[model samples]
Target: MSCDAIGSRLTARDIGWGPNAAHTLIEKVSFSLDAGDRLAIVGPNGAGKTTLLRCLYRGLVPTTGSVYVDDEDIHALPARKVAQKIGVVLQEMPADFPFTVKDVVLMGRIPWRVGLAGWTDADRQQADHALEHLNLQHLSSRTFSTLSGGEKQRVLIARALAQQPQIIILDEPTNHLDIRHQLEIVDLLSSLKLTVIATLHDINLAADFATKAALMQDGRMSAFGPARTVFTEDRLSGTFGVKVRKRPEVTSGFTFSLAAS
Candidate 1:
């Protein structure tokens, strides 16, 4: 029910990345959060939310600045070390190689494996635990490629959990889910003990899930702070081109009306 406070901190210092100044996707964005904070990065499409996320997870090295984990530059760490600390669930992925759902979940154990040894019993147990946690045990024997989008998303999250990572970075984690599953995912994330950084298109869900938020606009961080503060009506309306209202009496607590042409 509560985060572990593993004692490590994730900080982004003046991070910027792009091929050149003419095309910098993310620019000079900076923020810091402790191990348990759920920081939702929200912005309009092309606002560079994904780009900033990649930089944070070291999926792409920033052209400027650096990301640090407890004073150690993330880029300077070994890939295995990074993998050990950070688990990633990207947007819906295609699997062509014909692996079972269990096989895919077991892949998370690769970080803990040595040079060429096969999966250990501990690996299978961890994978089983993750599968049960995500309620994917029924899909374990199914071919990963044959599953539905929502099922695949849950399997991917199970894989991330199998990693037993300190930080989990997800890009559009709820893309393929329905309303029930979306709420389940949100609740599951809110209950996690690790740090979470994710991009969300649904403003209300983001507000409900995040303890802190970073609002991006045109490759820059327009606002960063507590979720309620960063997701003010003005910020959401101006950034999303909609009239947004806070309705604290409701579950998600926000409502939106589109802008008139």
Candidate 2:
């Protein structure tokens, strides 16, 4: 099916895959994402969380079922068209390249550009807006390799936003940040009002930003629903094999917790 038929920003049905392995990495995974919804995906290490994101981001095709973006089958759409609508910030970025922060972020706009022509004013404007959104305006001219780990992560996020996609997928985006920056990124994404799908090891942060949550284990979905329902002590403990406590937030309309999984 074409992406335009679903009217959802992202969708997956019965997606599964495994190569020369005993079991499939992901199995019968089906989900749909409406525009502007935030979904936090939680799973143990090797639970196929990263692999699932890869499939959605068009990095790997599923061995069965299908992935759709805005009603178009991801496999059917051109890569450039897919890039324009779905931006991704991965867990780790490639190193050894000497591009500047601005240079790296601007790469997001390549899909919209033609030939080897110079970047247009609108391109610079979009890149600048993204940098500003991440509060990295001052570091635009800095070399990407010279930045700290957290800074590089934010820059990659900026690059994703520069694409002006309808949805953004972040895989362990907060893996290397201090507490303050981690909270900042979560807050920023929450306020952007875009469809966001994130795989986070930090349950508290996920609960803080997500409107909905999905728990995965053993290559299958364990549970998924509103944050309030999914983050309960019982549900969390059962999934992670840990003790957890949920505390409501005074400002935000959500809760935070510590899981002893």
Candidate 3:
């Protein structure tokens, strides 16, 4: 699938969110994403990565500025319409819903439904394809709450894929998983043709998988650009408050390690 066919150009302009003038979780964050760009938002805890993502996905309305999808203001669009264009896999999971894995995945089709009726055959096919894509086909009939953390994460990703959105936003998609699973999840994301924006804690993974990277600090965008340009030792050390150094590569890809204090 080409980006022109499945992706939406996403832009956030001067976005800020806070309850009052005295407090702002994120401010003056702006970036534009073209089709096929995989952008990673990287920051330490309390750096507003998740908050910014929430604003983009319409989970939280920005207190200032706007987010546009394909040149349309996202806030002005209907919630269902926004949901159709942007698929999100959040960091938190639901509190033990009784639905099976397939049932939960089928919920992705709710935005497309025209009436109060149950899912149609087309919805089932889409859900099934998503399940297979995420390697969750064998677990379709399993209870959602019974799955392990990695399984649960894949299920949520399957649900997002079932939505068939133009863009996908993931908040820490690799959280709570082992190293192998983390690599697997990131690898799967790299293979997708859709526009992807994610918050990644792993700097190495961001360097390898993200075409663009944004560094956030104290509610501000410190840097945003191509991953290679933004992931340098000076920038990484400054943003993270650690002495970082690029390790000598024994392999093809770049790697970094913290220098001793």
Candidate 4:
């Protein structure tokens, strides 16, 4: 099935999160995302990329500011309502589950199901469709714990797709995939029409997959704009504390590397 066009507009305004004023994890970060936009949040470790994503998906509340979905305060909405609007796939997975792959993916439909009812036919169909879209139909009956890292990642993505959310937030989507799977997953995400917000570690992958890039440093936004414009050598080097250089080839797309000091 084609992606539904329920893409939402997400906005963050001067958001700050932390236990106390002296230890802010994310501060004064603001950005806007329109429908059909793919945004890549890139930064080094401890740059608060994950923390910002937590705020966007309402997993963690901001201490000082707000996140809005299509002008509605996300924190004001019910958690189930927020789940209906935004789907999230985090980097970590639960340690153990005795359920089959299909069963795991079907959990995504929880937000849509009525009170205390078993899986309906429509929910099963949606789960099946999501499995097929991710090419996991053949493994639908296999135990989720037996799958490889990349397979688990794909299963999580299939779950998010089954959620049928307006906005999808993925933290380190390509974390443990092999190079080929990484490219394939990134390419697949690029084809979707929904609003996507992902934190990517690979600069080249971010450059290829995202329309816009938000560079974060020390819990603050260092730059936010078109990927090509924001991922310059100077900005990358400054944020990552490494020398960077961009190389353009005749046939291949732009490639980046750490320059020799």
Q: What is the C-alpha lDDT of each candidate?
A: 0.87, 0.82, 0.89, 0.89
lDDT of 3 by residue, 1-261 (tens): 212236789999999999888899999999999987899999899999999999999999999999999999999999999998999999988769799999999998899898898889988888998898888999999999999888888898888888988899999999888998899899988888789999999998888889989999999999999998998888988888787777666321344556677
- Overall local distance difference test of candidate 3: 0.89
Instruction: Please tell me which model should have the higher TM-score, number 2 or number 3.
Output: 3
* Candidate 2 residue-wise lDDT, 1-261, digit = tens: 111111237788998888745778988899887777889999888888988999998989898889987788989999988888788998877776599999998997898898889999888888888898888999999999888877888899888888878778999888878998798888877876678899988888888889888998888877878877887777777777676656554433323345543
Give the per-residue lDDT digits (tens) of candidate 1, residues 1-261.
Answer: 112324257999999999877889988999998878898999999999999988888889999999998788999999899988888998848756499999999999999999999999999998999899888999999999898777888888889888878888999988767988788788888888788998998888898899999889999999999997898989989888899888877755778899888
What local lDDT does model 4 show for residue 171?
98
Writing each residue's lDDT as its tens digit, candidate 4 over 166-253 gives 8999999998789988998899789778899999999888989998899999999989988889988788888887777677562213
Q: What's the ranking of the predictions by lDDT, best on top?
A: 3, 4, 1, 2
- TM-score result, candidate 2: 0.89
Candidate 4 local distance difference test against the native: 0.89
Between which residue pairs do clashes occur in model 3? none
Residue ranges of candidate 3 with Cα displaced over 4 Å: 1-5, 250-261
Question: What lDDT score goes with residue 112 in model 3?
Answer: 86
Model 3: per-residue Cα lDDT at residue 24: 96
- Tell me how far candidate 2 lies from the true structure as C-alpha RMSD in angstroms: 4.2
- How far residue 176's Cα lies from its native spot in candidate 2, in Å, is 1.8
Q: Per model, state how many residue pairs clash.
A: 0, 7, 0, 0
Work out the TM-score per prediction.
0.93, 0.89, 0.94, 0.94
